[model samples]
Target chain A: MADLILLFFLLVCAVTAVAQRELLNSAIILSIYSLIMAVVWVRLGAVDVAITEASVGAGISTVLFIAVLTRVKRREEITRFRVQVLPLIVVLAVGAALIYGTLDMPDFGSAAAVSNTHVVPRYLEKGVEETGTDNYVAAILASYRGYDTLGETTVIFTAGLCVVLLIRSEKKRRL
Target chain B: MMDFILAKYNFWIYVIIMMIGFYAVIAKSNLIKKIIGLNIFQTSVFLLFISIGKVEGGTVPIYQGVEAVYINPLPHVLILTAIVVGVSITAVAFALVVNIYREYGTIEENAILEMSKTDD
Candidate 1:
């Protein structure tokens, strides 16, 4: 019951943030959105995901957003906040397609879910034995999925390197 | 009818939130606003994946050497990487936005368009 109400409030915060007049205000609301989203993940039995969301979504992202917001103009243009119809229609169509597609999916928390049946049991049974880690998610991430995590780390490194390059170039030009 | 709504309402709510983000990304004029929309859209997908990973009487996927159901661990691992990637992408995006503002002097879509037209 509480989870349902939280989801509803999440939707409201998300929409309100989108409609905010100031980019800074939107960023703040989005930070709140991320925080609530973390709680939602906890309710869904994903503690690791909840931690990641709280740190990445609510903490670091908000700081980065505000730092950038300070560098740019604070307020969004009011003259251009017009109701756009064609995009709304397009978004609605895509959403309808998604909803129709979900009718066939397994119900939430079904033990017989296909995802729960295959490959999952193997990981569950052998995960600790293979990786010497109690947390299967961590074991998979660090051992079974080592290459994927490395690639993601490299991607983050590349992104940071690119940002540094861009900022340095801008500064040199200014100098 | 109530049971149907209860059973399927999560999917519908996520879709609606996803659409709101989509609409903002397409319709908003401000670059920063678009970034926020992109974040919302990205996280909605995350929530959808998390919802799928739930189990009827499951605990978190920390093995305890005892009998218990555990939620799927794959999605959680995948989403952790994705969240990091999303942040890096946002960082690069904001850097680009800053450079765009320096080059063009405005982040509003229409203003940037007009500036480029004047440049041409």
Candidate 2:
């Protein structure tokens, strides 16, 4: 019942955020959407992901969006709200195809689902013994998948470098 | 019919959200709106993966006495990294958008395109 309500709000937020004409309002709505998403993650049994979503999705992303909005126009140019037939058709077609694809997915939250039967068992069974961490998500992230995390860090570093290179004022260079 | 809907509603909702994002990306003229759409699209995919890892009756993937049924930890770990990466990508995208505004004096796609065409 709670999941149902949260999911419904999720849909509402997604639609409302997209429909907003003001970029700042849209960004704020997106932040609220992220907060709802974090709660949904908690209900889905992912505490670590919920925390990250709360911080990064709702917090940092919103801040960055607003910062950019300050430097650019906040109001999207007023255009006639005519139905964009081509994009609408394309979106509908893709959505229908994806819905058809989900027909074969295991019933939601089923323990016997394929995702649970794979290497998950080993992870759940031996994770603590092997990694000496109470949090299996942390253990897997830091120990089993440390290299991936390192790569992800490098990606973030490259992004920061790109931002500095792209936006820093030329006056700063001379100074 | 009810069983079908009950079993698959989450997936359906995700598809709807994904389509909403897709629509914004392709239809919206503002570059920032397109980036917002991209964020929504990325987050929906993350939701799908996290949903796949859920167990009907399970606790968070942390050690809690040997008897606890923990949901899959792998997906959480993967998504943890992904969320950070997604934010980084958003930052880069915003930087590009800021640069575009700097050069063209407008962020709307149509305006920028028209300006560029007149430049040529």
Candidate 3:
């Protein structure tokens, strides 16, 4: 029942956020959407993901969006809402294909699902003894998947570098 | 029919959310709106993965002394990194949008394209 309500709100927020003409309002609504997503994660038994989504998805992303909005226009131009037919058709086609793909997926929250039956068992069974961490997620992230984390760090560093370069170029152009 | 819908509703919801974002990305003329749509699209994919990790009667993947069902930790770990990466992508995208605004004095895609075409 709770999951149903949360999903309903999630759907509403996603639609509302996209439909808004004001960029700031859209960003704010997106933040609310992220917060609801965090709660949904908790209900799904993913505490770590819930915390990260609450902080990063709702917090930092909103701040960055607003910061950019300040430097740009507040409201989208073209007051009237015009629907583009080509994009709408394309989106509907893709969505229908995705729904068809989901037809074979296991029922929601089923323990016997393929995802739960695969290599996840070893991680759950021997994770603590092998990694000496009370949290399986931490153990997997730091040990079993440490290289992926390293790659992610590198990606973030590259992004920061790109932002710095972009700002510097803009300043030089101004001068 | 009801049981099928109940069993697969999460997937359907995610697909709907993803499509909403996709429409915004491709249909919206404003660059920032496209980025916002991209964010929504990315987050929905994360939700899909996490939902796949859920177990019927499981707790968070923490090591408790008692025998307990722990939801799949692997997806959580992967998504933890992905959430951070998603933000990084957003930052880069916004930077590009800011630069586009700086050069063209507008962030609408159609306007920018028109400006660039006339520049040629």
Error of 1 at B17 (Å): 1.3
lDDT of each: 0.90, 0.92, 0.92
| lDDT for each residue of candidate 1 in A47-109, tens digit (9 for 90 to 100) | 999999999899999999999988888888866556988998899899999999989988878
Q: Per-residue lDDT of A5-81 in model 3, one digit per residue for the tens? A: 99999989998898898999999999999999999999999999999999999999999999999999988897456
User: Where does candidate 1 chain A have its weakest 10-residue lDDT segment?
Assistant: A73-82
- Provide the lowest-lDDT 10-residue window in model 2 chain B: B96-105
Q: Estimate each model's TM-score.
A: 0.97, 0.97, 0.98
TM-score of 3: 0.98
DockQ of 1: 0.85
Instruction: Please give, for residues A1-175, the per-residue lDDT of candidate 2 as tens digits.
Output: 9999999999899988988998999999999999999999999989999999999999999999999999999998956677699999999999999999999999988899988999888878888899999999998999888999999999999999999998786235446
lDDT of 2 at A23: 91
Sort all candidates by TM-score, best to worst.
3, 1, 2
lDDT of 2 at B46: 91
Residue A105 of model 3, lDDT score: 95
